[model samples]
Target chain A: MLRLHGIVGDRRDHALHHRLHHLEHHDAIEFLFVPEADLGRRRLRALTDRGTECAVSLDRDDALYDGAVLFIDDDRAVVVRAGAPRELRLRPQGTEGALKLGFLAGHLHWRVRFEGTDLCVVLDGAAADYTARIAPLLDDGIVTVVGNAN
Target chain B: MNAPALSPATPAKTAPAARVGIGGPVGSGKTALVERLIAAFAARKVDLAVITNDLVTHEDAERVRRSGLIDPARVSAVEAGACPHTVIREDPTLNIEAADDLERRFPGVELILIESGGDNLASTFSRDLTDFWIFVIDVAGGDDIPRKRGPGVLKCDLLVINKADLAPHVGVDLDGMIAEARRVRAGRPVIVTNCRRSEGIDAVADHLEREVLFRT
Candidate 1:
């Protein structure tokens, strides 16, 4: 990712940076989901607006937090949403279940938090559909709805 | 090739000072190591300067400056602005600028040591910013640290297990810890040190002279 390189300074990269800067003010808003672990990492992203795609370079030593505005101007701003781009919630049976769920969440690069005995996971939407196959690996933890996130 | 008339008369850029990064978790003896290095390098007469990064304060820089080991003027402080690792790895522009400034102020400085703000094992220095880096961890932090095999432990140019004299007091198996570190690094250099007693420091200096400074 270009942003992972630190700063976008070359003329070509500068032009794209300015273009994205302009898009930040337009009515068409795009969502960039930032995982908790990636909050402090440097990276580049590509965004599309009405079939036109452009690169957005985040080149500063900046930390991305949930609800932090990624881009802003007088008219509108693009904000960050916390959690995985997709997610799943599971109700674990006990301590072993919690450990299994935690291990799976880490292995899958899913951000997870516990609500009492319930495991709330933020991960890929596709993985949520595999609830039938995943439950057996989690020490009999039951799968819940896939889309719910905070 | 035809060039502008002014280009031919322009002075060529000088070589920048070699930069070394010191990074480790909080309370891991990074500052202590820096203090020792200051004295060691000074005795060798290596023209050097230092840069210290702190989260919100210049405490580490102040400490080094007040230690009287090196000139206070040679030490610079950088505030990491809450993202400690980001300043060193993700975007090292600020540190680069500081190192450049040091080179400017103390012309002919051969080396610059950049001390990162105390952070977790995930922290590392950007190669673009540092020519070489040393990761310092202590025996008191527990032997499991090597088993964890964080990127810092595996990737640092040199790994320093500091506070070795405390191994007996802390119930750490010194040889076992060093053995695991060697295993994880696959024979990369790992140095055991007791900064408090100034033990095993010459080896570090020798490694830097050969590896970083190419001094033989």
Candidate 2:
């Protein structure tokens, strides 16, 4: 298993981006897709798209972000790609219910947006976990789970 | 002048300190327990640091720093704002950053005691923030507390029943409270302590040394 200690650069860096583009033409770019929740973790073990096993142990203060470049060599490059954002769509029963639901989401610091009458919440973890926090509102019919937005 | 050259990524030189969280209701002796543990670990010659999450003020952090049990510089304070539980459990980025700063400053630190602001029984420490956590409850809070089975009590690595000396005055049966706590925790470790008198503190330190630090 190859042990990755830190991020060399990110794809957003122009030099690295150009290098990645050049490497792609040679079929030498591999990607590791990391989930949103796991980004904050300092230690992780995952396999690349080509089935190469690697262990990542970042510094205490460092967090993994999208497009992190883990390793690069003359022949190949390894990059990290964050998974797609997962979200839950909810509809409150009334104005008061919307206020309460909004308050709860704000208190929990959940990233959310309003779309028509629905509240779309970007989830950091499982959808069930977010719903569980608002279970009382659901049981009382103050809010209803419309569906997954993504 | 020569241009600086890029260096290859290097692994972290040392492991981060073990983080332990102490959480409980208002006036449940969370700060008192932190002070006591500071003394206990100091006596054991363990390198330590502390982070206190005060709801609106730095009162708890100031108190710990003034105790003189550890270096004042080693103590860090985090304002948890209105949501105490949220800072420790939901969005613990502030606390994580504080702990990381302490580790960076004190490389020899073996443990960091994170004291949460007083909160409700539903409060818990996120696994990403704490390696081990203890929920502190007092006898005066009522003997029914354990039977209520809040997540903080049921899920903590250790449960502490503080202010045991007040059990008689508060009409709380200490033995029954301990038994009920053990029952709710499904036979997990529970230690009774009177922080004012420093009683049963060694037991708590022993548990930390064995379970968290793996010193045993």
Chain A superposition TM-score per model: 0.36, 0.55
DockQ, computed on Cα atoms, for candidate 1:
0.01
Estimate candidate 1's alpha-carbon lDDT, on a 0 to 1 scale: 0.70
Q: Which candidate achieves the best TM-score against the true structure?
A: 2
Determine the backbone clash count of candidate 1.
Answer: 0
lDDT of each: 0.70, 0.84
* Chain B structural similarity (TM-score) per candidate: 0.92, 0.93
Residue B150, candidate 1: C-alpha displacement in angstroms:
0.1
Q: Candidate 2, residue B216: CA error in Å?
A: 0.7
In model 1, the runs with Cα more than 4 Å from the true position are A1-150, B1-14
Candidate 1 chain A TM is 0.36
Clashing pairs in 1: none
TM-scores, all candidates, are 0.56, 0.58
Residues B18-73, model 1: lDDT tens digits: 68899999999998888888889999988889999999999999999999999999
Q: Candidate 2 chain A: minimum summed lDDT over ten consecutive residues — where? A: A37-46
